[model samples]
Target: MPNRRAALLALAAPMLALHLPLHAADAEQAPAQLTTVPGPFRADAGSLKTYQAPAWFRDAKFGIWSHWGPQSVPRAGDWYARNMYVYGSDQYKHHLAKYGHPSKFGYKDIIPLWKAEKFDPEALMALYKKAGARYFVSMGVHHDNFDLWDSRYHEWNAVKMGPRRDIVGDWRKAALKAGLRFGVSEHLGASYGWFATSHGYDQIWPMLGVAYDGADPKYESLYHRPHNQPYRNSASWYTTDKRFQQEWFNRITDLVTRYQPDLLYTDGGIPFGAVGRTLIANFYNASIANHGGKLEAVYDHKDIGSGEFIREAGVQDVERGVMEGINPLPWQTDTSIGDWFYSEGYKYKTTTEVVHMLADIVSKNGNLLLNVVQYPDGSLPPEPQQFLKEMAAWMDVNSDAIYGTRPWKIFGEGPTKAAAGHFQENTAYTAQDIRFTTKDGALYAITLGTPTGAVRIQSLGRKAGLEPRPVKAVTLLGSATPLRWEQGDDALTIQLPATLPSAISSSFRISF
Candidate 1:
């Protein structure tokens, strides 16, 4: 009987191994302590002030982000997970009609539905590289409390459920193979308070008194307990509870220790004050340890010139808006192609608009982290693919004007003024709108639109009051023919060829 049992156990071992996730197995085998030191950063404002943005991040001006996850499962656009619990909300209505009520089929049910079978990290990374992305950011975790990596601290992770794949690990591997810097964006800071609505039930009719699945104690780990004081608005996104703050610190620390990403982006302001500082310090210290004591990691947040911690800590990230001028410190603008997530029938930004935004942001010493929305099956729709193709063509011709360039004296000259602050309207630029960037003693003037016969740059004029520099020669970036040009006190005029270099925005390299 013992011999027969041993044979049966041996036969079942292979089947069990086959069923287990590859990343989970790898995590189990890894040494408990991988780094030489746990961390070198402290939970104080003064300790964090010593940090600075890395040069590599400054040089790598553009990055692409995979802002995807189970929230994208419904294809209803951004904030589906949170909004679905809100009674009478559009997503709530959709959930009731399609899947059932939140009382029965809540976000938990949607989690298993995200198969992500078509997700090909290598292929997608190759495409992003072709689009001229210097860096790539993957969504490590969002407000839904679902970690994308092979998380040891949390059971509700990608390896254990949902896609059942180590999404972050796979993305990092692909980015490294493609020779691009890898980064991760963590929206987990606000998870505790943001998900409070999940504990709510319908106030109307048949299911009025029934509690949502979030009220079940069995799934408490996934859907956190309702906070005594729920978040009333964005100002209260982060909870004051010490327990949630500690949890945030532990989870984010685990992420940094495990991945050692080149960049760490926080969705909101450095959260929970001291705890947030600790997380930032750990991320920085871990990055330094990984790179042999020289810090290469960049921590991005959304606080602009406000608190002492924010101003001194890391790069400021502006969401859905542009700065008025060149910031004294380096910054970034993280916007999306369309909606934050996949939304059917949503109008996306045009290729021209994207290029224009990129040029405008770069001219003001800011990086543009564009989110290219992906479908649940991990494939890009035809519209986004077309946008990428067009961007690739534009980058092929005018990438020199973008990469490794600094802002000129002025950002640009245009009638269309960009509305400042978050959620501002995007303005369309005409032919007259011009942005400037300088690289290796050469100045690049990028027109927001195609010029007619000749292009006039008033900024280069002697009388513009801006100190004039002598121009040696002028040539189009994608064209070899020397452009006919004259520099005068009034304006610097350049003759255009019968055919433009590229159909999109044109770049003229002015060598001094």
Candidate 2:
């Protein structure tokens, strides 16, 4: 993850590193840990080489995740860390009004309010499976310092507090029963820097002197005591503490060893030290041994200076965005219809929007992990429910074209393009865009928008001087009838039969 000023910096020159030097072409640096270790795969298992990402994740293009946790308690947006800082943001305003002033009602108080009253792991798993999720990941913990599992390392967990339930455990069980691989996300790595806001406030009385429970020693492990400044100092937010770096490494190791997560996602870069990288290597090797080397594992951290060393660290996860251009290596993009957490009056993406986005992403050799914001009580809002239903319906009709498919010569032929960078603004698509994917010699052409007449694909047609390869058959997914196609020298034309099978974007399989 880039720093707080990365966007602005990107507008100028590329952001300069404050900690390490810019990664150069001949960079000889080893990953954060275990430079001597060999990869866990059978080919490299003879020596102590670092581990590399498993093949299953690179091939299994689609997976789903349950990002919900105590943070959803307020029924607001995610960003609980940053919003809790700004004095007038919707979340900040809500926090001041409902709980008390910011100085008095810190987010720590928000913990006890999280009652996963309606949480039903089985039901949610069923819905996710119907939506075409091949694997399921649940939040093990977030930056809020709350653990969703029964943790022996940290008692400030679901079983010990608010929900008084083993949220992650139940989710794992449900995912396994549904025949989906189980994974866990740990945002704890960034808490040291991101949650520094909790230390900022006024100094007075019931409304002043008190900070969030972070300063208290009882919660130090949960909050991660940074050594750069005294616990009570106001300067803690700006200062970077090296001690917390080690703390991050230790806690993550604990998380991996106990849960043995098939997939592990760090919210940001794996902690600053080589130790964190070592833990990652250990996790991959151990998981392989535990599962007899057949069940592959994944570790999703940010793209830390790409190289053979970084690739060995784990898979890259883009949050709310995707990599630019055609990346041969597999990747995952996670986004939500509205907020990452449930909110009142939240507008969701139309079914057309989601389906088109999925088509575009899959064609680009990436998987889409769509996060739906369920209410704190575990009940999904009406809009989210409808969104999931529509997605499931689309998948029901087009699953064959999406799952287990590979990209064709081109990802798509369209004017409507999705964002190409991290944290970039999302845009809508038009009828001109067409994404392409392939499976078993079949070409899946996805129209980004609804078209009323014949569609012309220049890449599919013959030239004026010569005949193009003829399309043996053309069929719109979800429909039994075959459509007529003509191959001209310059384009392949498929005539629409007056109406589309669905209101959303439609796709057709062209067999050569």
Candidate 3:
């Protein structure tokens, strides 16, 4: 469980006025006021319970997220900003050799190194669209306390530093030009605590007791102001420092007000209780105005449970996780190619694994928001670009099974039992693993791998009585000829044609 969930449970109510201590010494603060835009939703739990996931988000089952930012500058994987300050850590040693010590050169100095000179949004968006991304999300703000957009509330932004370009705005334009929905992800909710490592000095001999650059008051804005707390990850991860809480609200509110994104993804759950809820209400109201008085905005809240709390307000998201079975409500699984950011020599997920994940997620009434890591200079790496090309080829023929489809009676029938939950991304599935999706008059049975001969789907068996409708035709998606098949009391068996549509994953279209 995450810190937010624990905090929510401990609250006497459903996180009403989820603010920190109001004492002057603690930095007095309260929830930011809601936007003037009138809408059906409100900050209250009762009002937000009526919130609905947007139709665009439901249909856009596959989205590509640019989880890129200055953090990619090190090419040392995720948490570089935090880990670089820790003595003897991989990123720390790398930074010490490549740049300098944290006391002299901190994360603030690394910001200016991210000059995305080669970033061509048009080309990148084209690749993503071809890779079957119906929606694209730009990193709004990450835990490094850097805003990827031109921020009015924060000076540490892309427009002023790093790329000196409006990364989020440019990505949105490219996404729209390619006829895809655009969204923004904000990881700023936990930045206050996530960045606390920067405030520390090296524990080792050469630099022991010497404060890092973040200890200086001049860099406090870049690395958040100091807090008195242990590094233990808990509900406290969401800081109780009221001023920081209000800062989170103000900056994210500015992002929503300026960007008016089709979707808004908070890295954590309804942040700062009323503060986060109010921002969500404001985002929804703005989206309604932009869409001719209709609520077409999706608020992504990370909910690993029965989607009870988040389903009341927005689309529930699971990070690097899968549901045991089909989710009753529409959900999303946000994962990355390797780490959240580009890492040196990272072994990426194979094309087959990605296809399997997509098929499985869509079958379980969920979407896959894969993070395609980017280089610091805004250019696509060769390996990930190749990965996209392969994915595009697979989607070219099987997209009909993925897009605009709903889950069937069962998610799938397989010998491999997936350990479902957060951070469990890998599952070994044989050709026997079959996933199902239904659209109109068609039922798509997608095998995780190429079936050698005859394949049996127990879930479709006559005795199992799952599929009441008689099977009229069974054909491989990329093939024109119908496959010879049988529906018996035990299972639905089908013979494979000489050629297969995709070796990565096969989708058999069953018409009844």
Candidate 4:
């Protein structure tokens, strides 16, 4: 099998090589040069192999993301644009009932409905900082092909249409004001084919013969022209069309050039082969130019574990999933409170679930980028606001264990094994489950749930085979006095106080 795989890769070498250096030559000749030489990244895996995640990204463990956009306008949750085109789908029915048929009132009509009148970046940024977010990410563009930022290339943008505001710029200003790193997420790569559904017609309808608005050539730029294949095909995620690829390159390049965000997140794996590589290279090169030769920018994309190109170029981002153990390199998990976009009646993850997930991910050398859903009017409902408040109160007492910490020898001690991969169910941790993180020679043992009378950590036992270090001092994070503890060969038992410090997870700082 290994020999066969190697033979296939060898046969594909020429095809892969065709994608290299597409923009490297042009970037080298640009008049306003960002770097003396060509950009730091290249389209091939060889050049990107030198990339490493920066220290700032590794330290800024927790980040808040606003996945807000016109898709939330209908309050029907994620994939509203595409799903609304899918015949017999819930969104399709909702669109038909709410406004009209796709032939008349489509996603284009929904764009103007996003007023964002209640959206106050300054106020939201303050809440995020208080909730312990070290970084903020704003939606630059989703699969709908609408730019949330002020776009110079495309006319379908936030400034000209929805909200009449540069959403990315406002979020960036707010994040910087709150001393938080800012990032942007671009889902445009898959959008070309993803939005192909817009060009489709209802198979069984009174208007069956009539085509959707996407078929109109006047709006072809906004609703992308139909591709050869059906929607949601794996290969179609990043379309094979050269015209679309070039457009993707131009728009993303404009985004990086205009914003110079601290981080850039691609919704899928590095896309469009050579064009994608050029985008990453230009991003890094521009970042270095902005930071006086020190690249502070970080790029994140999905890693399927088979692609060396993704593993080498940027931080691996798992969508609604987790790594099984401590990854040799830093990575991230981008999940949301409820639906990716706002849904009228969606249930959100509780604060306890979020905190426990954070601790578990951090213990495995991972960061969490959580999306707090917002309404179409740009306001969070009572439930999400309460969620943020709870997070703030918890962070007030236990943030020392979360920020600027590294994984310990072992991630945790627990019986409930967390299922690994995207879309897996969240683990329900018991009081016995414990996660570990460390900083400045101190170990922090975070109990997933508050224990009653006594807490025992088997990982710290003398005979646990980890060659465990002797505990010299142990103190509860929010408590003033030290706790009484005894170490045995089998387990380390600590007598807990009748009352706990925080209502959520409890942390014990251990010094050797």
Candidate 5:
């Protein structure tokens, strides 16, 4: 498991790191937890290494995610529940000015405010399908511990609260109707450690020592059980409480058993050691049973960090980042357009940036799970809708290059280098940046940005030795005209047309 204490610290919520055990990644730290489900794989790494990603997930290079929930009710971006109780943080100020203090109006109060009146899964799924999304993931649960489905274990779910809709079921139906795969993300593992903030008290003169709404016994299920562990600023982010680990296992197992999602994404590394592993084993067994003895499910997690990159356990998920090079096994990169949740003043990623990231990720043998930010009502703001439309227009020409493609001999020839690993998402690429992907017997060279004139692909050059085969023909993806090209020992130069099909980026098909 990759240590994610840095992620929490990066969020400006370091106090949440308190009460976290130092041995979070220790398998022996957890009791010998086991699931009743039958399967060939064990909860240990050696047995689970035989797991392989299904063909559906690999062929589907792009997926869309709805990271929406009650947190969006404040329209205050990511981590509203935790930050709102941090005294003077941005979300805290927003919460105080808008809905009084944490003592009165807590995250529980924000639940009913999330009336997804305009939420339409069918229509949105259709739009995503049109935008070239081959798979869709809905938020099954977040660190808020609020389930966004018709949950069997927990009572605080979408079926009974908020919109009173079966969010996950509706999404699965809609995705299947649109001929797209369905998946769900679970952030419940770290909730035990994260939601402890709700138990804080105000230090100000008026509200000094006043218990927040979370400390009340009535809302224990929502805010979590009352814990008095001192906040230790350190690397641990997962709680050591065995009880919470059991709860996490039960809730997550219940979610997987019910929905049977094609994919399951955990926010951080596999949590609670043996507890998490057994849950995964059950998930895999269930997938096999559902798919006629074939494991057709993908379990995604960010277990890649430092010098460790384990491909055997499950698909390695890079959050807002990409692999340094082409990986041997299938993986994914989950990112968002603006904030994880919608914010009024936040600057969203442009269509070109999204396209570039998708291209880069696909070239490196990974899929991009993009989160389309939505409002509390489940209606998309104009920005995200426009982003999807623009992406669809771009995919009109470049879809073949992206989907069902594998990494070539080399990822690409580019001067703009993307910082590898987690949280290093921002990368500025020029027209010279070309990423490579292979399908059938052809090679695809995608420009990260719009090129002005002729472009040179150094990797395709004869002397480069990356592509030693002779080139038979060259053609642009959207253009009908054959490209005027010349190959040299140094680089393969292709003359650009006066007008291109799409303004976002371009893909050139090379047949050798």
Candidate 6:
């Protein structure tokens, strides 16, 4: 497998070079109301304020985000950058067939085609709630340079162009009415430079003179046409651009004031300037003001000093992966079953895969914010919808082992192991892998895979030479009758029922 950092840098390289200049005037200019600090990080105080992340968020183990935007119109996998490069790539082929050539249509034109036709917010919310999602996060803006909200700062917004409605407002209303915390993700920061690939063309193609229309005068804002740095064919082309950096600032500020979401997530670290600092401060202050300064806010930003800004004021989130080891503050890994958006050929994760991933993440002291991709018309694909139903069915009966629980003496006895970081390949866990969580002094042991009949746990009351706590009772979650158990010096054995509630996995709660 390719090194994870190299893959991450591949994602970050285009944006960093395009948006950060060695010397730029606007980088020094402080927004009127925003705080001013230099560099990419926000400073951390010695002691963080006493702030509790909202109760609803803590209880909400699952959420769904509409990562869709103009990008989904291509019906391709995520990352329009690399996909648009390979001529044979599904996205590239889709771009060519649906919209003429990559040159004429470019990505900019697709922005208008995202009609969001079947976008019935209330109906979608109902389905999400039914699927066991406790919160909803709508895409406020993606790296495609389009805002889903009614932006006062930019004309490239859903209300003015494509959907012709305040997408964020509709979703917020629906989520709040359903008693779900509303959040907005900001991929706008990286948009400044990430989309610079709009200027390049495939080296070998079906036809010649097929460069994308990044420099077209009429569509400058949509493509982020930077004035000082001319588009070049060099690999370092976007990294040296200056104008894109300034535009990045303007777009993010507009998003902050317009949405005021309960959660604000940046695609990467904030910009490398005082403006970035101000953006962070404003995000916190806005959350404080929105909740009358009582409820703590959440900002899912990256590269902010470790335990610095997050430990002090906000929460941290990982995209498509999780942290290497356990973390002090609560963190989340955002991923989906298949593509980030709905694609006809996309394969959703199996119920077993999803359940085990959740259990593993919780065991390591993290949360899983899963995204179930919905079709452009706002309907979930049958496969994902079915997967959600199965997951909900499992969660319904075994939720006691998950929600409102903390890691126990050890996070289970298991032979199963998951990768430690982002974009790592997922490996299957065997029945031997067990994850543990505790609540009210009761230990909940979850097996990654279902056992045939009886199960033995070697982690507790034996391996460590601790006092052998006799198994007073062992109950398989979601089953009608409590399973019988007997304890020996080395392990505790429990009888499994003839039938199981779920084929994916099972859990047991052992009370002292």
Q: Compared to the true structure, candidate 2 yields what TM-score?
A: 0.84
Ranking by lDDT: 5, 4, 3, 1, 2, 6
TM-score of each: 0.91, 0.84, 0.93, 0.91, 0.93, 0.85
Q: How many backbone clashes can be found in candidate 1?
A: 0
- Per-residue lDDT tens digits for candidate 6, residues 5-31, read 234344334433454234465344533
* Candidate 5 global CA lDDT score: 0.84
- Runs of candidate 5 exceeding 4 Å displacement: 1-33, 229-234, 304-310
lDDT (Cα, 0-100) at 281 in candidate 3: 83
On the 0 to 100 scale, the lDDT of residue 237 in model 6 is 22
Deviation from native of the Cα of residue 130 in model 6, angstroms: 2.3
Clashing pairs in 1: none
lDDT of 4 by residue, 316-419 (tens): 88888888989989999989999989998899999999999999999999999999999999999887899899999998989889899999988999777898
- Give the per-residue lDDT of model 5 (tens digit) for 469-504: 888888898899778999998889999998999888
| lDDT at residue 367 of model 6 (Cα atoms) | 71
- Scored by lDDT, the top model is 5
lDDT for model 1, on a 0 to 1 scale?
0.80
User: TM-score for model 1?
Assistant: 0.91
Cα lDDT listed for each candidate: 0.80, 0.66, 0.81, 0.82, 0.84, 0.66
Give candidate 2's total backbone clashes: 13
lDDT of 1 by residue, 1-512 (tens): 00111232233233223322233232233222212235666667777777778888888888999999998889988878877876766777888888998878989889898889999999999889998899999999988999998898899999999899999999999999999999999988777756766776666678765778877778888878644534445555676666666677778878877888999988878877656776677778778878898889899887631122366678888888889898877888998998888988899999999899999999999999999999987889888899888888999999999999999889989788988766653888887899999999899999999889999999888789764567789999899777899988877899998888787799999987
Write candidate 2's Cα lDDT for 459-490 as tens digits.
Answer: 78755322245678889988876687788777
